[model samples]
Target: METNLADLPVRIFHVLSRELGRDNLWVKIVDFDQDPIFSMKQLEIDNFLKRDNCCDQVLRRWGNRGQTVGDLLRRLQLLSRTYENEFDSIQLQLRRKFKILRWVPDSEEQVTMAVDEETIKLECKAQGFPCPTIKWYTNDSKEPVHTGRSYTVLRCKCSTEHQYKCVATNEIPEGFSFSEHYKRPGKLWNSVLESDFVDITSLVRDDELCESCKNFEMGRLSQILADDEKVENKTIPVPSNLDSTLRAADKVALIMSNCSYVHLPELMTPHCDAQTLADALQKMNYKTVTLADLTLDEMRYFIREYKKLIGDGVYAVFYFVGHGFEVNGQCYLLGVDAPADAHQPQHSLSMDWLLSIFRDKQPALNLFLLDVCRKFIPYDAIGAFVEYSEQFKKFHRAHRNMVYGYSTSGGVGAYEVKGEINGVFMKYLKNHVSMEISVMSMLHGVLKDIENDPKQIH
Candidate 1:
């Protein structure tokens, strides 16, 4: 939180005028320096200051008579020192940027320490005007294992290998915080930059291993196992360089989550998940259209109209959370009205068709997030699902700016705990969407979070 001397005066002046009346500030300035000529205009002295509006005029008057900005700053600092108690309170309330300085073990090095007896100590360092708090977690656990700059891990058997990660954060009055990088420690900074979840060590105790554990490590380095799903609300810093480009583009999001179904099993988290995502996107200035439980025809109708909102530089996002399946390498989203026993394209919306429509609109970014299962259909249903026509096969736009982020890989089922608010994918994604990185890079971070998550690791 090192202050920029150039802007420091303006910030200090703003607080002084609000805490003390304009008349009192003007009188104090004249008496503090005992200058023979008072340059402040009478109109400015009497002006009703609503926030910082009148500060500009007063500063302009102060600068007119052979006085530099630095001169004004020097005068302000003198006043600040004279009223130390009051100035201290005001300075404490002023905003400061938070950032991570360095990690004890740099994640980029990918150092693999093999230990069977010695304990390991891990630490992270950060600095801000108001210091940021540090928290540590093992693997994908939501709750912090330790809170502070450093943590110690005891030696464990091969059965307990795990990765450890640390995060530093501080709140801003403005709900969202800005981001910037620093060259070294103790430099003036910035956000929630995290250490790569790193494997602290690999231990192989041959005598302590079970049959399955023996086969799992088969001469290779021991890998961490298991998934745990607990929800931790964290912020991602949007870097300054990408700020303008992300904010400049027209952003529109269409969120459709179907939980109630006539033929398929009813879900518990879709409604809650959709709302959570909508709130997060809206904070980032996205125009969000959130809908639920749409039928096949309704899905088609809404999508057709949704594309109209996309223009040359628009950033269009389409998200669907519901029952879904893949067959012959093609994916389909199911509707509430889909049949129970026999499901076909007629009762679902084809992904190819969705991509084709968006490709023609020429948006700057086309992002699709599917928070549903992609397991293959039964053999009996395969023939019916593989009805792809020649047109569908030829509709490939490899050069288009499109990204598909699926919750689970093909032939795998995505899970939703009965009482959880969000599915596995959205649980990690909501924390990453606002990051000031490329769309792919943001999604890659989400992927890493998912990989570390104990519940979603499988």
Candidate 2:
């Protein structure tokens, strides 16, 4: 993690200076492990010819910062936005040399502890950009025994030793093709990383217990046995049908997909993915509006138009796919012309703004399904263009009819698997969106399906 920026390779220094500008005051040499500080520098215009693979090392070093290549490229693109004369040509040159980088969970082995007679604790250490998800499972069981970094199980003296498995995973950046040469095989850093099995011993022997304590333990054990006997007689409840008040005619959907880009890295599958979801919803009798590759002004225009379509007691869904980033804990969807380095609010649609606009519509369900990265990207400055209401901060708290379904966790990116026609989120969403069941029920099914596929572990 040690880096001396001033001592950087001559090739990398050239790339930064040339792209970020020799005198922009945004390029500096310092510790990259911390946030980069921008400063001005001047270099002699030597007759240096660029090599074919000069940027490869630059890519590797940046990727190690727990950032995808797409994120790094977007930042560079924004910082160089003022270079309008040769912008397209220079950006294209940079793009040709870059490939998308996906993050995976690098997990350590499990740490187990026998905390108490009634509880056995297991802890697994994992490290990743957004922190990996941990799930603990018993031997040969398809379902997880517990979830989180620490898991506790009820200990019984009659039980035998058992093996527990720990799994850690994080989302990968979406919508980029990877060549076979860049792919890692049989490595733990491949989306889902699992730890070695940790065995748990039986509870303390009966000889170690006093007479009074033994009697108390036996009484509790007998009660548990009685509860198990009753559980066998219990019946599984069926999912209730969709509410009678909710009609297909009362449903509406707005789907936006940004595939092409002028200032940011272009995505490959968002347009097609949006269409697939639109078609699926249409079959279920919901009114659908699907649009693709919109700029900032166009996105705002359409959102305003879509807001007029909502009515009282109606089910409204807003689905977006494309480049998105989080700043100051607030999420924004990037427009095609959103600058890489400045005026972000003017060019991007704020989720809070959207929620504020819709909360007053009194829709029966205001659901948002966002399939984008939630990475925290620091911004240089803000020039307000969009008027966001502070009331939306408590919108979710005041409304019980709102649901936000994210493709990935906060500070992590979503994935678009290579060779697939759609991103992983939309791929599974299509399977359950048309079901005639409650909205929460449908979402649960989609989550279960995604969890079952290791490759789809975003």
Candidate 3:
């Protein structure tokens, strides 16, 4: 415990110093109670009183700089001339509580199609103080692959996207760790960043600005733009009206539902919900794609594909009907294959992350309709399971027209009515979609239908 306390200064300095752009920052832990000079009783204990009992070394850690805390402070103020405002700012950062503002990955996932031996670097960046120590590890080992500072490099073993975890820890406040899986392409740069589970893209490549990378990019650009040359890998027809034809329609619907649980009671309503909603969306002039009973990775892949399809003009509508629950204020949409034992399954997609997809795409309007509940989950501790998705949704300050519609309000369990063809939300949504009404009116109908049910209450 003492050793841990001793490491605190260095730990704080690690994260804070990097953010301060200072390489030589150090920590000195001074107990206010133990201070020989400038304590509450320090004025009474003069130089004569100090020589009577206390050691000289204990008297002045700053060593010849000053006699008291006030003198030391004045000395620091005098020395502040060299750094100007930066010294005060750095001091303020250290003197305050530890915090992480936005820890993000710098770049998209790196995929290399390299065959011959080549080196690739992956990086993680952190924005917090004291600056967090960035370390890399692989293959589930306790020993790190790389430690001290940011970024790590590895030689290519194959066309491998080697997975390395970069951890940034202050061990005082919240620490962040993220996995960076980058393939061995040509030389890249930087290290990994910090997060709860944020897999940020890699940072912009400084190494790639070299002659070889520039040449490669230019060649690729030439190949893409070459109108006079015959393209060998031509799949799509080149239209004469290039500017008019490139972009597709913005109004789209993503309908995903999971009914088949591996160990839990299978839900029949979600599958029914997805199919009916797809039909309704089609009638409403929305291009809808429905994916049902998907495993964890399959859901992620589909969302990724959906992200690629969305553009700036997209008015995207996402509908998820599935078993979902909150763990420590974070809500997760469980896939068909989510583990029964794991409280926080890696496979379970986060609803906040789902909304971030549209933020990245910068959509015109994004509406999320979640028909999620774990009412059927065979858990005896009914009181223990809490609802936090509503809170989670509120936390993200969306920059666009974003609406999060749940089947019911948070903390209340949604029930599956027996003999009903679909879930309450979907049944009414299907009914209202055919009536040629707005989505707001459709939702109002859903709420009214749910309120009228005998077995359920929101």
Candidate 4:
């Protein structure tokens, strides 16, 4: 006669007895409820005697089941009301934290802080989302008293040294703060400037004649040669030492791509895309150059040479595509041959170096396109990931005549499609330019189209 018993509990008990040993029954009983195979309340004395602590023993007793009890439990928990509530709360918090307000600088009404003989004149119009409050404080005081709306003019009567702090606070639910600091005239100069100049000159030059003496002589010569018209509008031609020459043109485009080695197969794509863009600009009667074909040294030489060639009323377009790394809130673009090793400083190029070149020249419309996202590496790599900088955004806000476009938003990777006519971005750009689309329209259209496409890797 066969005894009637549930198959799962019976088999589990048998395996448990064998694995734990019949003498060790108390151990099994104590841990039985904790075993994931059995529910907390389901482990009774009989079932406790069956199962083992070992994974193999328990798995065998479960008999090759399609879904484990643990999996079902997880699925059920996910579908439960408590889990759903927690998820909703988390999403709400995320939304609140990331909500950014539209902020426009009050450029129309200038904020002028002028230091005359004694007093300092402060003029500013307060305008921001949820309007800002202005507070003025002196270095001597810890508390800042509110200054009336119109202006705050601080007089320096007895105090030869004073520091003014202007604090602008936002009236949001959680206060946001911004402050500007200014020192009294002639105070810092005597303490900091003279020593700094002397130190810097000493460090820069070790000649027998002191730099101070040389500067005095140069100052005398400058005074003797000074004519208002001649000194104010003096022009220096680009150095002729370099082999490169910048031709005169209505418009110029400087392309710098650092991902040449990693994206070697994708070369034709950028080349065609750049040419198409050039064609569009040419139709509008502007000259262009794709700097990807030139070496880093050559590119630098050509840029310096071009400043002399194109004096004024000239437009410029600069494009960069590559892997970039950010350290201490400054972004560095990787060259084609930049080493993957973190310790090699010589391999990277600073973004500021590139920007400084154009800024020195002061082009009418300096358009920049950066396609460099963080480099991709195997997931198992041990190095810590570095964060990108706010400088990218700050650059856009600080400069008036400049426009910048990035392949992807911050902290996101920009992707290149395989088997497409070009990299996804380049392909779209080429098509738009070939159709004679305006620069602004092309950029807007591309971004919009990317939003709708499911395959967009970015």
Q: Which numbered prediction scores highest in TM-score against the true structure?
A: 1
lDDT of 1 by residue, 143-242 (tens): 9989876676654343347788778764332322222222235554445657677675553221212334323332211111011111133222333663
Q: Candidate 4 lDDT (Cα, whole model)?
A: 0.43
| Tens-place lDDT digits, model 3, residues 1-458 | 11221133554434433433342221122224755433433353344234432223333333333353334343334444433233444333334333442353333422112222234455455444334466666644578767654443423121122455667663232222111111124312133344332222232211221334334433432332332322234343334664432333446677877777896667867866877877777776666666666778877877765664455655678888887865544456887788775344455787666766545566666778888863333344333333424434554664646766778766556567788878777766677667766667777887888788676634
Cα lDDT listed for each candidate: 0.62, 0.59, 0.52, 0.43
lDDT of 4 at 267: 39
TM-score of 3: 0.41
TM-score of each candidate?
0.45, 0.43, 0.41, 0.38
**Which 10 residues in a row give candidate 3 its minimum summed lDDT?**
174-183
Residue 443 alpha-carbon offset, candidate 2, angstroms: 2.2
What is the per-residue lDDT of model 2 for residues 123-159, given as tens digits with 9 covering 90 to 100?
6655432245678877778998688867875453322
Candidate 1, clashing residue pairs? Answer: 98-190, 227-454, 227-455, 228-454, 228-455
Q: Which of the numbered candidates is closest to the native, going by highest lDDT?
A: 1
Evaluated at residue 54, the lDDT of candidate 4 is 42
Q: After superposition, how far is residue 251 of candidate 4 from its true place, in Å?
A: 1.4
Worst 10 residues of 4 by lDDT: 189-198
Q: Give the residue spans of candidate 2 off by over 4 A.
A: 1-249, 379-397, 456-458
